[model samples]
Target: MTIAVRTFSQLNEAASAIASDRDAAFFGGGTLIMRGINEGHAHISAIVRTTDAEFRAIRTAGSNFEIGAGATMSDVLANRELSFLHEAARAVGGPAIRNMATVGGNLFARSPYGDFTAALLALDARVAAAGSSGGRETPLADLLRDRERNGHGVISHVSVPRPAGGAEMRFVKVSRVKPKGVSVITIAAYLPLSGSRVQGARIAYGAMAPTPVRVAAVEQALEGKTLDASGVAQALAVATDGTSPASDPIASEWYRREVAPVHLKRLLLGQPA
Candidate 1:
C-alpha cells in the first residue's frame, strides 16, 4: 500500500491531521517511523510533517530552556547554551544520525535508544503537546507513561529549567560498543547540594525498565546525605529497586542489574567508568 505524506506549516493543522487519521503518524526525523515502514510494521498508512518555524526553534529565557520538538540532535549540539546536554545529545548516534534525529522522536524511542529522554527526565522537563482536543503541558514522565495512547498528538516543544545554583548534574551512558551504540544502561542524576548535604535529588535511568524511570528508593535513601562513600553505599543498596530491566541482544537483565550500581556509584563520586 502507498503511504500518504501530509505537510503543514501550522502545528494545530498537523495535530488535527494526525488525530483525525487513525493510521497516520507524525514524522519527526523519521528515525523510528522509517525503520518501522521498512521492516513492514504496517499500522501507519499516512505521515504528517510540519514546517512551522516555531517547531524548529530553540529559545531560552533567563536560565530556562524551551526546545522545539523538531529541534534535531545536531541543533542541540550547535547551541553553546545547551553545552551541558552536549554529551547526551552526542550519544544519540554519529553526526549523520544526529542531523536527522529530532528531540520529539527520541521521546518515543524504545528501550536502549531513549538515552536523551533519560537526561531530560533528570532535568525535570515538561512537554507541550497539541491534539484535536487542544494543547496542554505535561511532565515528561507522565507523557512517557502514556506515549502509546497519546502518540498521535503533535509535540510543540519541551521546557526545562536549569539546575539551580549549588546543584550538579551528571549523565553516563554505558554501551557495549564505543563512541555510538545503544545503551546497556544510561544514568542521569541531578543533585542539589546545601553545603555538603544533598537535598532533593532526581535520578533517572534508561534501559533499566520498559521505559526510562526514576529510582525513588535510591533517591529517598540519599536525601540529606553527603556524596561521601557512606551515602553512595546506601544508594547502591537500593539501586535496583523499582527497576525491571530486560534481557536483549545488547545485554542481559542480570548484567544490566549488576552494573547499574557500579555506574551510579561512578556518577555520584564523579569518577570515570
Candidate 2:
C-alpha cells in the first residue's frame, strides 16, 4: 500500500482536514509509523505532520502538568521539571529511537509493552485530544480503552497532576538488553508517605498484562500501612495475583509470575529491583 505525506502549518487546520478523511493519520516523530508501514501493520493514503502544532511546549497548566503532543522523548528527558517523566523517557528506546519517539505517538501506539504508557499510568495521567468534535480530556486508562475499542483521532497533549505530599517513585524493567529486548515485566510504583506510614500507593504493571493496569487491590491494601518489609510482601502478593501474562519467545508466563511479586516487594520497600 502506498501512503501519501502532508504537512500542516497549524493544529486547528490539521485537525479539521484529518477529521474530514476517515483514513487520515497525524504523524509525530514517525518512529512507530515508519516501522508499522515497513511491517505492513499500518496502511493509509495520507499522513499529517505535527511539527507546526503548538503542542511542543511543556508547562504547568493550572495545577496539572501538560506535555505537548509533539514533544519528543528526548525533550521530556531533558526537562528538569518533568523528573518522573524523565525517568520513564530514559527507559524508552536507545539514543536514536528515543530521539524519534514522541509522547503522543507512544500513547496512541497502544503497544502493551510500551514503557511510556506504563509510566503515564503510574502518574495518573490524562490525555488531551483534538478531534472533529473539538477538544476534550480523558483519563489515560479510558483513552487506551477507547483506542482499543475505536481506532480514531489525534492526541494533542497529556496532562498529569503534580503529585501531592511526599512522593517517591520507582520503575523496573526486566530484559536481556536495555534497548531492544521485549520486557518480561515492567513495574512502576508511586508512594506518598506521611510520617512513617504510606498515605498513598500506586503500583502499575506492564508487559505482564494486555495493558498497563493499576494494582488497585494491592494499592488499597498498602495505603495507610507502615512502609515495612511485612507490608511490602503482602502488597507484592496482591499485586501479582490474577495477572494474565502471555508467553512469548523471549519469556514465559511462569517466569513473569515469579519475577513480578519479588520485584514488587523490592520496589515497595524502596529497594532496587
Candidate 3:
C-alpha cells in the first residue's frame, strides 16, 4: 500500500500511520526506494510518498537558499541562484532521473550515492523538520553523523547560508559518465580567502568514507597559505590523511586515496576534473 499526502497535515497523518507499522517507510522521489524494493526488500510493504504540494518548492532570496524536501534536481539546475550547485545537480542523473530525485531523499542516501548531499555538507546546510514532539532545526553535519536519531521526522526544508565575503564555492565529481552517473569520488567546498591566503575552508568529499567526510586537517593546513601551486600540493597531500573507506567494486580504497588529492586540487583550483 502507498499513501499520497497533499498537505502537511496529511503528511503528518501518513507519518503516524508509518510509525505504528513496521513495514511502512517514507518514500521520496522513488529513486532510491524503488531500487531497494526491486532488489527484494519485501519488508517495505508501504510507502508515504512525498510528491505532494507540501514538499515541492525552490525559494532563494539574497544569499539564503530554501529548498523543499520534494524539490527535484531539475528544479535545482534551473535556479540561477544555485549556480554554485549546478555542477552537483548535473552530476545527479539524466533529465528523467533528475526530474524524479528529491532534495530531502538525498540527505538520507548512503555512501557513494548522495554526492549532492556532500555539497550541502560543505556549504554548511541545515534542515528544518517536524516530528510528533515539535519543529526543529539541525545542522546537516550533525544529522549526517547521527542519521537514526534525527531522521524520524518530516523534513520541511533544507537551507544554506551565504558564504563570507571572498568565499569561493566549488564542486567536482569523478564519474564514469559525464552526464548522468554515480561518482567514484565527489568533492565540494567553500574556500574563504584573504588576498593570496586562505582564511578558512569547508571541504566535503563523498565516496571516500562510510559517509561524506570533511577533513579538518586539510582545512587547517590550507589556512594562512597562498592558493598557489605549492600551497595546493601541500594541502592536497594532507587531504587524504585520516580517511577510512572500504574497498568497493566501483573503486578501491587505495584508488580513492590516491585520487582524492587530485580531485581536491582540481576543485580548489577551479580546473575541470
Candidate 4:
C-alpha cells in the first residue's frame, strides 16, 4: 500500500496528533520506514515527520545525559560528550545507516541484532516519553520489554547515567564480514575491579535468545573472582547455560551458542576461554 507522508514542525503535537489520526504514524529519519515499506513489513496510510522538531539535542540534565530520540547514530558517535555510545553506534550498519537510523527507532523496533540495546542495558539507560498520558520516565529495559506500553507518544529523550566506579565496559558483536550479516551474538560487559578481584560484573548478551538476556549466572561467576583462565571458563559455561537457540538462514544455533560464550570470555578476560 502507498503511504502518504506529512511533516510536522513540533514533536509532541505531531506524535499526539498521530495517536488520534487512526491512519497516521510518526516518521523519523525515514531510514527504517522506507526499508520496512520496501520489505512489505509496514503498511501504514500516512506518516507524521519529526524532522522539524527541536528534539535532537544531546545534553546533561541532572545526573544523566539526555539524548534526543531523534538523534542519529552518527550524531551520537560524533558527539565526544557521548563517548560511551560511540563504539556501539559505529558497530551499527554502515555509514549511510549510521547517518539515518535514529536511536528511538532502534530501541522501539527491538530488533535482536540492534547494538544499542546491549550498550544501553549496560549503561542503565532510562527513557522519557510524552503522550496522551502526559509524560514519564521508565527503565529502558522495562520499556523494551513492553513495546506497546507507550501510546503513540514520542520517546522525547533517553537518560544515561555517567559510568561509575571506574568500570571497564566492552561491547562485542560477531558477524560475518559486511553490511549484511546479522549478529551471531552480541555481548556487553561492565566490569568493576577492586585490586584484581572483580567487585562487580554485569554481562548482557543479545541475538542469542528471543530478546536480549542478561547472563546473571555468568555475572555471578565472574563477580568476586580474579580474571584468570579458570574463572573465564566458569564464566563462559555459566553464560551458555539454559539457552535454547534456533537455527536461521543467517546462522546455525550451534554456531551462535558456541561462539557467543567464547566471545564473551575473550571480551571480559582478554584471552581465550
Candidate 5:
C-alpha cells in the first residue's frame, strides 16, 4: 500500500510508518520497488509516496540549482537551466521510462543502472534530506562512501553547483543498446583546461565498480599536465588503477577494465572508438 503525503512534515510521519511495520520503504516513482514486489519481495509492506508540489519544483534561482528528489527524468532533460545534466538524463531509459523514473530513485539505484549518479559525482553535488532526526545536508560523495550509515533519512533534494562554462564535461554511456537499458560502462568526466594545460579534473566511472566511484588517481595525474599524447597516455594508464569491476553476464571484469580507459579518453580528449 502507498501512503500519500504532501509535505515534509507529513512525510516524516509517513517515514515513521515504516517502523511500525516490519517492512516498509519510501516510494520514489516505484520503478525498482514494484519490480522487487513482483519478484516476490513479500517483506515490503508499505510505501511512502511523495508527490508534493515542492518535490516537483525545478529550482534554479542562482548559479546553483537544486533538483527535487521527486523530479522526473523528463523534467531534468527539458530544463535548459540544467543543460549540464541533460545529456546524462537523456542517456537513461527510453521516453516512457524517463517520464516515470524519479530523480531520487535514480540516486538510490543498486548497480549498472546509476549513470545519473556518475554525472552527479563529477559535478560534486550535495544531497538534502529529512527524517525523524530532522533535515540535514550531505555531500553526494559522502553518501556514496557511507550509504548504509548515512541513508537512514529520506532524500528531499540534491544541490548541484553548475560546472564552469569553459570546463569540458562529457557523459559516455556504453550499453548493449543506445539511449536505453543498463550501461556496461558509464563515464562522466569534467576537465577544466587552461589552454593546452590541464587545470583540474573530476572523473566518475559507473557500472565499472560496486558503486559509481570517482577515480582520484586519474584526476591527480591529469591536473597541471600538458594535454599532449604523453600526458593523456599517462593519465589513461592509471585511470582504472584501483577499480574492481564485478564479473557478470553483461560484461567481464577484464572487458570493463580494457574499455573503461577507452571511454574515459574518448569523453575527455574526444578520441573516437
Candidate 6:
C-alpha cells in the first residue's frame, strides 16, 4: 500500500491532521514510525510532519530547560547548554541514528530504546503536546503510563528543571555492544543533597519494566541518607522490588533483574560498570 505524507508549517494544523486521521502517524525523526511502515505495518497509511521552527527549538527559561519535540539527538549533543544530557543523548545511537532520532520520538520508543526518556524521567520532566482539545502539559510519567490513549497528539516540547544547588544528574546505559547497541538496561538518577544526605531523590530505569520507571521503594530507602556504603547498600536491597523486566534477545528478564541493583549501586557511587 502507498503511504501519503503531509507536512505543515503550523502546529495546530499538524495536530488537526493527526486528530482527524486515526491511521495517520506523526513523523518526528521517522526512526520509529518509518520502521513500522517499512515492516509492512498497514495500520499507518499516512504520515504527518511539521516544519514549524518551534518544533526544533531548544532554549532555557529561568531554571527550566526545554527541548522541542523535533530536536534530534545530534541537536542535543551540539548544545553546550545541554551538556548534562550529552551522555544520555550519545547513548541513543551512533552518528547516523542520532542524526535522525528526535527527542519527542524517543518518548514513544519501546523498551530498551527510550534511554533518553529514562533520563528525562529522572529529571522530573514534563511533556507538552497539541491535540484536538488544544495544547497541554503533562508529567512525563503520566504520559508514559497512558501512552497509547494519550500520546496520539502532536508533541510540541519537553522541559525539565535544571538540577538545583547540591544536586547532580547521572545516566548510564548497559548494552552488550560498545558505543551503540540496544540497551540491556539503562539507569538515570537525580540526587538532591542536603550536606551529603540524599533528599528528594529521583531514580529511573529503562528496560526494567514495560516502561521506564522510578523506584519509589529504593528512593525512599535512600532519602535523607548519606551516599555512603550503607546508603548505597540500602538502595540496592530494594532496587528490583517493583521491577518486572522483560526477556528479549538483548538480555533475559532474569539477567536484567540480577544486574539492575549492581548497575544502580555503581551509578550512585560514580564507579565504572
lDDT of each: 0.89, 0.77, 0.77, 0.75, 0.78, 0.89
Off by over 4 Å in 2: 110-112, 131-135
In model 4, what is the error at residue 176, expressed in angstroms? Answer: 0.7
lDDT for each residue of candidate 2 in 210-233, tens digit (9 for 90 to 100) = 777777878888888877887666
- Model 4 / residue 213 / CA error / Å: 3.0
In the range 136-183, model 3's lDDT, one tens digit per residue, is: 667888777877663456676788786677888888888776666577
- TM-score, predicted candidate 6 vs. hidden true structure: 0.96
lDDT tens string, model 4, 115-201?
777788777788887552544778887776676654636678888887776677788877786654567777878788888888767
Estimate TM-scores for all models: 0.96, 0.92, 0.90, 0.89, 0.90, 0.96
For candidate 4, give the lDDT: 0.75
The weakest ten consecutive residues by lDDT in model 3 span 1-10
Per-residue alpha-carbon lDDT of candidate 5 for residues 87-181, written as tens digits (9 for 90 to 100) = 89988788988888888888878678888889999998888875624446688988877775534567778888888867878888998765475
Clashes of 4: 0
Model 3: residues with Cα > 4 Å off, grouped in runs: 1-9, 61-63, 132-134, 148-151
Error of 2 at 65 (Å): 1.0
The parts of candidate 1 lying over 4 Å away from their true place are 131-135, 150-152
Measured with C-alpha atoms, the lDDT of residue 44 in candidate 2 is: 77
Candidate number that wins on lDDT, 1 or 4: 1
Q: Model 1 shows how many backbone clashes?
A: 0
Residue-by-residue lDDT tens digits, candidate 1, 4-52: 9999989879988987898888999998899899999857889999989
Error of 5 at 46 (Å): 0.6
